[model samples]
Target: MGRNRISGVIPSSLGNLQMLNDIDLSRNALVGSIPTSFANFGYLFSMDLSNNELNGSIPKEILNLPSLSTFFILYNNFLSRPLPQEVRFLEWVGTIDLSGNHLSGNISMSIGMCKSLEKLLKANNMFSGPIPDTLVEVKGLETLDLSSNELSDSIPPEIRNLNAL
Candidate 1:
């Protein structure tokens, strides 16, 4: 139910829809955390929950779904926390947008494990620390925007190796 101005917490029971492949709850007034039960979306390939008031840390269980290939949780009311190491499990994910939130901590080096990652938009958050060296390993990465974060350190020289950039 995208752009429906839907308010209130997401129902965990939605996860029981085993056949669900895509979910778009963007442009809503949803509150509360993303339900852990969402991990049950075993067939889910894409999800968008942008422009909402959803608060709390992103659930790692949702990130570990093997079929998740695209995700957009931008412009939300979520708070600060490093992305889970399990985020690397989304090897099939090609695009991810986690911008315009309060997320903090280092961008995990394990992000390099996403071999298929092509576009990563993580600007306008509270992320700090040097850009992970492992980012250079994403040979297929074409669009990477880490702007407007609190990140320190210089651009890695190895970034030149990303021919797709």
Candidate 2:
């Protein structure tokens, strides 16, 4: 269920439903780290856990959801840590929202490998450094939000070549 006032931690048993395709637990009061068992959602295509009380580093295993195409975990409780390099595994993913968290460190250049990626919302975090030149490789990207971070250096000159922006 999504957009409800539901509170408390997500149940790990939800992972047992192999046929489940999407989950939207956004705009809730849910707390605690995401259930690691969610990595078992082989059929899951989308998930939104934004605007919740969830905390802790995202489980890297959850990034392996083979069918996952959209992910949103914005405006959450104190989640922190560098996004895992395995994020490139979301080859089919088109949109991702990880803004307004406590995440720190450099944005992974490998993110440019997500061939289908279009919208990337990573504003309002602690990311620092020049935008990776490799990001220009995401030829289909339409919206990229890196505002409010500590990034420095000149804007990648190649950014002008992204016709999709």
Candidate 3:
């Protein structure tokens, strides 16, 4: 459910659906961290927990979902902390949006490992440090918005080769 009056913490019991392919709980008043039990969704392809009151770092287990290929959005939440390095495991994901949060730290260099990534929106957060040069490895990246953060240094010259950008 999304864009509703729903409030309170997301139920951890929702993770028991191993056959689930998509989940949309966005635009709600939900609070609390994402349940680690969500890692059990082996078939999940897309998940939207955006526009909520959720806090805490994104669960590395969710990042490890092999079937999370279409999109994974946690936008406009209260989530914080460095994005987990395990995000490198999303090799087939097409889009990832973690914007409008309290997350901090350098964007993980390992993000280059997302071989199929297209749109990566990470603006409006506290991320600091130079933009990782490894981002050039994501050849399919088209819409990369790392604006509104504390990122410094020049954009890597190699990024010019990404024709899709």
Candidate 4:
């Protein structure tokens, strides 16, 4: 349904599509919460619910997907909250864009565990505190944008050492 102005709630039962490999509901007017049942899609590896009115934190099970490689939910109306801990375990995620939301929390040190992380766009949120030193472990990280936030603490000078690591 190209160019269809989809509105209203996404049917929760759509998550039952077990063999689903990808879902692209972006660039639409879909409202309401993302169905938690979608986590049951074992083959689900890519999802894009961006540019919508979806609120609340992302379902934790979405992160637990062993094959999830790209999780992009940027440009939504979701509120401030910490990223799920299990998300740090994604071994193939090369990029994560949680930008333009109300997300506020300490940047988890566990982000370092996502060794495959390359592009991380977290700008325009209420995220506070200092950057975690462990982020240096993401050797593939090429872009990190955290501008426009209440980040109060000064970035330690030692953070510059990440360039050498």
Q: Identify the candidate with maximal lDDT.
A: 3
Instruction: Identify the leading candidate in terms of TM-score.
Output: 3
Q: Over the stretch 5-121, how does candidate 2's per-residue lDDT look in tens digits?
A: 899999999888888788888888999988989888888888888989888887889888889876544555567888888888887788888988888888899888888889998
In model 4, which runs have C-alpha deviations exceeding 4 angstroms?
1-3, 156-165
Model 3's C-alpha root-mean-square deviation from the true structure amounts to 0.7
**C-alpha displacement of 90 in model 3, angstroms?**
1.0
lDDT of 1 by residue, 74-148 (tens): 565674587778878878888888888888899999999988899888989999999988988788999999999
Q: Model 3 over residues 1-165: C-alpha lDDT tens digits?
A: 999989999889999999999999999999999999999999999999999999999999888898999999999999999999999999999999999999999999999999999999999999999889898999999999998999888888888988899
Error of 2 at 11 (Å): 1.3
Count of backbone clashes for each model?
0, 0, 0, 1
lDDT winner between 1 and 3, please give it: 3
Candidate 4 pairs with clashing backbones: 80-102
lDDT of 2 at 143: 95
**TM-score against native, each model:** 0.95, 0.94, 0.98, 0.87
What range of 10 consecutive residues in model 1 has the weakest lDDT sum?
71-80
Candidate 1, residue 72: lDDT: 43
Ranking by TM-score: 3, 1, 2, 4
Our tally of clashes for model 4 stands at 1
